[model samples]
Target: MTDEAIRTERLSKHFGRTVALEGLDLEVPRGEIFGFLGPNGAGKSTTIRLLLNLIRPTSGRAWIMGVPVGDVRAAHRHLGYVPGDVALWPQLTGMEILTYLGRLSGRVDTAYRDELIERLRLDPSLRARSYSKGNRQKVALVAAFMTRPDLLLLDEPTAGLDPLMEAEFQALTREAARRGQTVFLSSHILAEVEDVCERVGILRDGRLIEVATLADLRGLNATVYDATLDGPAPDLSDVPGVASVEPLPDGVRVTLTGPPGPLLERLAGTGLVKLRSHEPSLEEVFMTYYESPARPETGLTARLDR
Candidate 1:
């Protein structure tokens, strides 16, 4: 069996003159929680739809659990998916909806399904039409987890969930990973992805810009240090690896790119009261890509070790 849960090659989808996705290539390993991140109109949904084979790609190909996406039945047998916008049969009760979906997948673990329902705090007896948006999301989440498929493709899975429920969702994701199930999470929520995913791929303008672990991404950018001093701050502009040094009210704010050794030595005897290092958050890294100009080519992959 293949170690890859998902793979794509030169995947492109064009709606007339509009390029939804272009020449994309990616691979998600088995038993991993990989995050797909981008803003609206960044082709995040398009990539999922192509993987699901809901829409035909104008060019290129994709596979799920080593099964080509062209064979939807075979490929789907190894995966469970939760869409950004869920639509359930209005006449069916939540439990009925679950039953129908379970039968279709033919892989439901009834005991586990019950546990998920309880954990999500879902009232399965309620009719679909009466359920609020968050309740609908819970039902979908339960269905996706109940199957325990090889791969879970979740697109904005926590859309309507409250903070508490969102936390529960993250917990469930971690549990799934521990069970050796791979999760492909496509979300605009940086915090959610940063909390669970081992690695993240940032997409922009229909292209995969970068793929790396959170630590590696942060390492690629400058590190910020805020120093509070009892006296005047020292000049760090000439210090090696120091990108920029700004005078703060109490001391100085230094942006360092590489080793901190040089910067630390320069700050010595400068009346340093406190020194704080700020690693770039996922959101900050994400914004950097969006704010910067798009690269001329795709496949800027940064597959780094943890």
Candidate 2:
């Protein structure tokens, strides 16, 4: 089997001149947790649809499990997918829905299915229409996970889930990765991606702009440092690798985007009564890119600069 479980080249899709996806090139290696990140209307759902052969691409190609997506039956057996917005048989119970989907995948492990149901704390007896948004997401999750396919494609899988359930979902993702299953997760929830993904691809305006590991991104923007001195802090505006410096009530706060070694020494020389470093949240990191008008120009290179 090829190391790349999923590959797409210049994948483009348009809806009456409204471009849904534009020249997207992506790869997902086998057994890795790859994050497909983008905000709403960024073509995340459209890309997944093309990969599933539910919709034909306007241009370019895609492969799933080494088989072209055009061959629906050949690729279908190898994948387990959970759509972002689920529309199920409202009259049916959650148990029935999961069982039906699992059976269609040509697998029937009732014990395993029940185990998943119990783990997710889903009340299978209730009709789908009565379930809340989070419960509906749980039903889809149980159905997808029970199939035990080689590849899993999840779209915003944790939407509406409670904190406890979200943590459980993260654990499930790690377990699947350990079992050598490839996961293509699409989400706007940055923290969840940071927790579960090994590499992430960011999309904006229908274009994929950056791809990098979490550690690499953190290194690009090191922890912010806040310090207060007995006197006014020395000017750090001219220092290299320092993105911005702002005055604070106590002293000053510095946002460092590169190595902190040189900057630390510079600050140490000034003498400090107290010092504190704060790591930015995923949202803060993501916003840095979104707020910037200039493009990163290259995949890995763009991420480091941002």
Candidate 3:
């Protein structure tokens, strides 16, 4: 069994009468990129704050590297974090800010810091106020990535990055994973999550509703298949694995759940001349959760350490 970098059990928080997080159970395994996804007002930031122990939880437990969250200093030692919105001293240079954060992590090695600066393409002389949104974001990323922590908690990590820089960010994340670092990345970008995350947890109304691998999610939804047959198309209404089938004069369309292997084999017997298959987007899979109360197959992988 893989060791977990972070675990939360029935973790909850309330701001007076307003509920922020309710029983948010999550697990991030060592050396894996775990994506935390939700829309606006879905309690993503609240959960991060709770895990950092910046605010006390109303109920449940949160642990970092098997240690309680309340032991903030000790727990933070093995972690690096980049917030969605960065606030920095207007007068301070980017390098100065990074150095400060590095110092906070207990040691400031010049060689590693310089390597991060070079990789991020950041200039040390530029003041915070002079930087654009992308540059500011880079500053924060450089700060966190420079530390080389065992785990990374990134919230809206690509907020201001352009396509090229976003690609660079993805490369950096994969590099971290290669080196056995755990990442819990929060994002609204479904495509980004699908690209890098091994598993994802979808949160709604402050509660975790689903957790699944990208392949698993793709398999759960309808897959589009278009096929051309030599003879008049056969009625595929009763075909197993197919959710819907549309028949045309020379071809047929079918949608299926789970693997396409069995469906392809069956289509072969139909004298198919051409066949095509397509998987749905993350948005489509997510819609299924909202369409009803039914949850994904990987319901809960972690117990609230409470």
What's model 1's lDDT at 139?
94
By lDDT, who's the top model here? 1
- Candidate 3, residues 1-306: lDDT per residue as tens digits? 338898999999888888878998888889999999877667888888887888899999999888899998888888888899988889999978887777777765678778767777778899999998878888888888777888889999988888888888899999999999988998878778888999998877778877889888777677778888888777655556665566766788766654677777777887989987777667546544544223344233222211
Reference-based TM-score of each model? 0.83, 0.84, 0.79
The whole-model lDDT of each prediction reads 0.86, 0.82, 0.79
By TM-score, how accurate is candidate 3?
0.79
| lDDT, candidate 1, 1-306, per-residue tens | 899999999999999999999989999999899999877778899999999999999999999989999998899889889998888899999999999999998889999999999999999998999999999999999999999999999999999999999999999999999999999999988889999999988887788888898889777767788999999888776777665566889999776667899888878778788999887676655543433223234422321211
How many angstroms is residue 278 displaced in model 1 relative to the true structure, after the best TM-score fit? Answer: 1.7
lDDT of 2 by residue, 1-306 (tens): 778889999999999989999998988999999998877877888999999999999999999978999999989888988887888899999988887887688785678788878888899999999999989999999888887778999999988889999998998989989999999999988888989999988887678877888777665555678988767788786666665566888788877666788777778878777889898656556655654333245222223221
Show model 2 residue runs off by greater than 4 Å.
227-254, 258-275, 278-281, 293-306
The worst-scoring run of ten residues by lDDT in candidate 1 lies at: 297-306
Candidate 1 RMSD to the real structure = 5.1
Of the pair 2 and 3, which is ahead by TM-score? 2
Better of 1 and 2 by TM-score: 2
Worst 10 residues of 3 by lDDT: 297-306
Query: Which residue segments of model 3 deviate by more than 4 Å?
Result: 225-276, 291-306
